[model samples]
Target: MKIAIIDDNSFLISSIKEKLSFFEEIQVKYTANNGADLLEKLDKDHNLDALLMDIEMPVLNGIETTLAVKQKYPQIKIIMLTVFDNDENIFNAIKAGADGYLLKDVNPHELFNGIVDTLNGGAAMNPSIALKTLKLLRNPVDFKDVSKEEINLTNREVEVLEQLSKGLSYKVIADNLFLSPSTVRKHIENIYSKLQVHSKLEAVQKARRNNLI
Candidate 1:
C-alpha cells in the first residue's frame, strides 16, 4: 500500500523508513517535514492510501493536519505516529479523525500490522491508547467548542496580536503601540500562554483560525 511520512525530525523519518523497509507491500511515496508541506504534496499526489504523521510540527501540527486531510480526502487513512501518549493528545487526535494512534518507538512488525489493520477498516491504537479511548467514550468530556473557545485576550494583547499579524518585529510592535519592548515581550508571553501555542507562527495561525485577531 502507498504511504507518506510527515515529521520535523529527519532522523525519526529515516528511522521510520528503515522500519518500513522490511515490508515489501509498503511503499514510501513521499516525506514532508511539516503539515503545510505535506498538504502541498498531498494536493499534487492525493494517490496515497495512508499517511504517518507526527503530532508536533512547525507551520501546522498533526492534529490540524489530520483534520484538514480528512476534510479533503476522507478515503486516505491517517495514523498519528508520535511519542506523545498523553490523554489530551490522544483525545484531540481522536476528535481530529485519526484512523489510528501509534508511538514512534513501536516495533517494526507491529507498525506494519497497524498500518494494514487501519487500511482494512480497523482502528489501530496502542493498548494504553485504546483503553483511554474507551474511558473517554464511557465518560465523555465537555469539549464545548474547543477550536473557537474564547481565549479572553486583553485589549492590549489584542492590539499586540494585530501588530504581530502584520509581521512586525517586537521593536516595531513596541514602537507602534507606544509600549516598552519589555512590556511587549511580556504581553507576547501572556498571549502564547493563553493561546497554548509555542511559537509566533503557531500563535498567529491559531488566532486567525479562531478569529481572535
Candidate 2:
C-alpha cells in the first residue's frame, strides 16, 4: 500500500520507516516534516493509499491537515500519530475526519495492522485513546426523544443498535447476535444510510429520535 509519513521528528520518522520495511506489501512512498510539506507532496504525487500524520507540528497540526485532506482528497485515509493522547486533540481529530489515531510508541506490527485495517475500511483508534474516543462520542443511557410505542425496529436491529450506542464493536455485536462481523457491519451501513448519518453518534441519536431502540 502506498503510504505517507508526516512528522516533525526525523528520528521517529526513520524508525517508523524501518519498522514498516518488513511488510513487502506496504511502502513508505512519501515523507513530510509537517502539514505544509505533506500537502506539497500530495500536490505532486496524489496516488497515496494512506497518510500517517503527527498531531503537533511546526507549519500545520494534524487536525488541520486531516480536514484539508478530507476536503480535498476525501478518498485518502489518514492515520494520526501523536505522543500525547488528550481529549481536545482526539475530539478535533475525529471532527476533522481522522480514520485512525495512534500513539508514537505503538509497536511496529500493530502499526502495520492498523494501516491495513484502515485500508480495508475500518477505524483503528490507538488502544491508549480508544476510551477517550468512546467518551468523545459514546451515548448516555438517557437518550432523548425515544418513542413510548415501538416504531418498527426489529428485535434484532434494536439489539444491534443498542449495542452500537453502548460502543460495542461490530465484532462484539456480531458475537452477541451470533452473526458475522461483516454482516453486523452491513447492518450498520444500512442503519447509517437509513438514518441519513455518517458516524455512529449520529446514527444512535437518529435512532433514538425515531424510537428505533
Best by lDDT: 1
All candidates' lDDT scores? 0.92, 0.84
lDDT of 2 at 86: 59
| Model 2 worst lDDT run, 10 consecutive residues | 140-149
Clashes of each: 0, 0
TM-score quality measure for candidate 2: 0.64
Q: Scored by Cα lDDT, where does model 1 land?
A: 0.92
Please provide, for model 1 over 1-213, each residue's C-alpha lDDT reduced to its tens digit, 9 standing for 90 to 100.
999999999999999999999999999999999999999998899999999999988899999999999999999999999877766678999889999999998999999999999999998888988998889889877654666587899999989999998889999999999999999999999999999888787788678867888
How does each model score on TM-score? 0.68, 0.64
RMSD in Å for all candidates: 5.7, 16.1
Lowest lDDT sum, 10 consecutive residues, model 1, at: 141-150
lDDT of 1 at 202: 73
Q: What is the lDDT of residue 101 in candidate 2?
A: 92
Pairs that collide in candidate 2 are none
Give candidate 2 misplaced runs (Cα > 4 Å). Answer: 139-213
